[model samples]
Target: MSEKKKSLKITDAEWEVMRVAWTTKATTSKEVTAALNEKTEWKSTTVKTLLSRLVDKGMLGTKRTGNKFIYFPLVEERSSIEILSQELLTKVCSKKVGKVLESIINDSLLSVDDITRLETLLKEKQKTAVKEVPCNCIPGQCQCHLVS
Candidate 1:
């Protein structure tokens, strides 16, 4: 995959369609719609529209096989997830990132191995982490503790 395709902002609807393409590797619109329809109430046209949007975003590649088009992801799933994670992290205040992560961890169901991995990662980060993370949010966004 090209570096340019490494980061993509897929919409919620497009993400559902991409999940099918990523899992299937290569699939037709009919197959994609069927897979998604098992849990969603989207129409064939809706799925097809999302497919087209993904193709436009360069997230999904296409091949014309007979009359139907076979769609496949141009990027790997893991890389896309990392990029999206970084993108989301950048949107929040630096000081609040830890709390954000903690909330996510609290809400998630992780296996023993997953918890172990997180502990290891935290240890590694502890070595270089600052004593305090300064507020990175705009003045209006964060509640200042300093007295006026």
Candidate 2:
């Protein structure tokens, strides 16, 4: 898949449609619309529009099943989240990653088990953490040059 496909930008409405497709495996536009209608005030046409946009964005794959089109997610939820997380990190200074992580941990309501899992992940990541993280900035976008 292309990088653009890997990191497809999803809107809130598109996410709602993707969630239905992901959970249901392969579903029709009517099914997606009905599922979303239970929780949202959106009309069937609005849901259909979101589904079409998702397919166009390469986030959803479509196949004709008789008179209806079945929709399935081309991108898994976990993969999409990972791409979004990496993109978010790219906007911030590498040196502030730890601080950002600390802020996230402090601001969120994590259970004891979640905290333990995070600690384990952190330990594993520390094994691969380099002493110096090289800046990938073009020129004046960040303060990496000012530091040295």
Candidate 3:
């Protein structure tokens, strides 16, 4: 897939539609609307619009079944979250990644097992991390160049 397609960002409403599609694997728009109706007050039209936007964004794939379209997630939930996380990191100062991650960990309700797993992951990542990471930001967008 193209970078633009890989970088598709989902909105809150789109996420709701995606959750239905991801869980169902393949479903008609009507089915999705019905599933959403249980939790949301959204109209069928609103759900359809979100589904169309997801398809246009390359986050979803569709197939025609009879008079309805069956939708499925083109990108998995974990993969989409990884892409969004990377995109968020790209917008921040590279040197502050640790600080940002710490802030996230502090604010999140991580279990002891989760923290232990994260610590192990961090140790593994440290082994392969480069001594220095180059900045890929546009000129004047970040202060990396000024860090000397």
Candidate 4:
């Protein structure tokens, strides 16, 4: 299958719609409206509008099914997470990645198994990485390439 590299920023309302689309594979607009109506307190029209907007944003693709449109996610959930994480990391300082990780680990409640799994992954990464590599950032944009 061909891949589309564009990243779409999902709004709060759009995220709800995306959850339905991603889970259902290909769902009709009417089905989506019925499914989300009670939870979001949104009318069928609102759901239709959200679907149209998502399609325009390139996050979703719509195919004609009878008189209605069936929606499918053009972007996978993991791909979206990677794109957002990269964007966030680029915006924040490199030194802040550790701080961010610490905050996330502290705030999240992990089981002992989860903690062990993460620790194993960290140790594996440390072992696999080779000698220090230079950061590819432009000189003025980030301190990543700066030498002490």
Cα deviation of 42 in candidate 4 (Å)?
Answer: 2.0
- Per-residue lDDT of model 4, residues 27-139, tens digit only: 97788988898898888888999999999999899889678778999989887778877665555555566677788799999999999999999899898775654344567
For model 3, the run of ten residues with the poorest summed lDDT: 1-10
Model 1: worst 10 consecutive residues (lDDT sum): 1-10
lDDT by residue for model 1 (1-148), tens: 1124234677878888878888999998899888988789888898889999889989999999888898999988888778888777767777888998999899999999999999999999999999989776656766754538
Per-residue lDDT tens digits for candidate 3, residues 5-103, read 346467878888888888999987788889988788788888889889999999899999778888988888898788778877766767678788999
| C-alpha lDDT values of all predictions | 0.83, 0.80, 0.82, 0.80
Q: Which pairs of residues clash in candidate 4, taking residues 3 or more apart in a chain or in different chains?
A: none
Best prediction by lDDT: 1
Off-target runs (Cα >4 Å) in candidate 1 are 1-7, 145-147
Model 4 bad stretches (over 4 Å)? 1-6, 128-148
Better of 3 and 4 by lDDT: 3
Error of 1 at 115 (Å): 0.7
Ranking by lDDT: 1, 3, 2, 4
- lDDT of candidate 2 over 1-148, digit per residue (tens): 1133245478867877877888998998888878888789788788889888988888889999788888888888888778777766666777777778899889999999999999999999999999987766656867787776
Between 1 and 3, whose TM-score is larger? 1
Of models 1 and 4, which has the larger lDDT?
A: 1
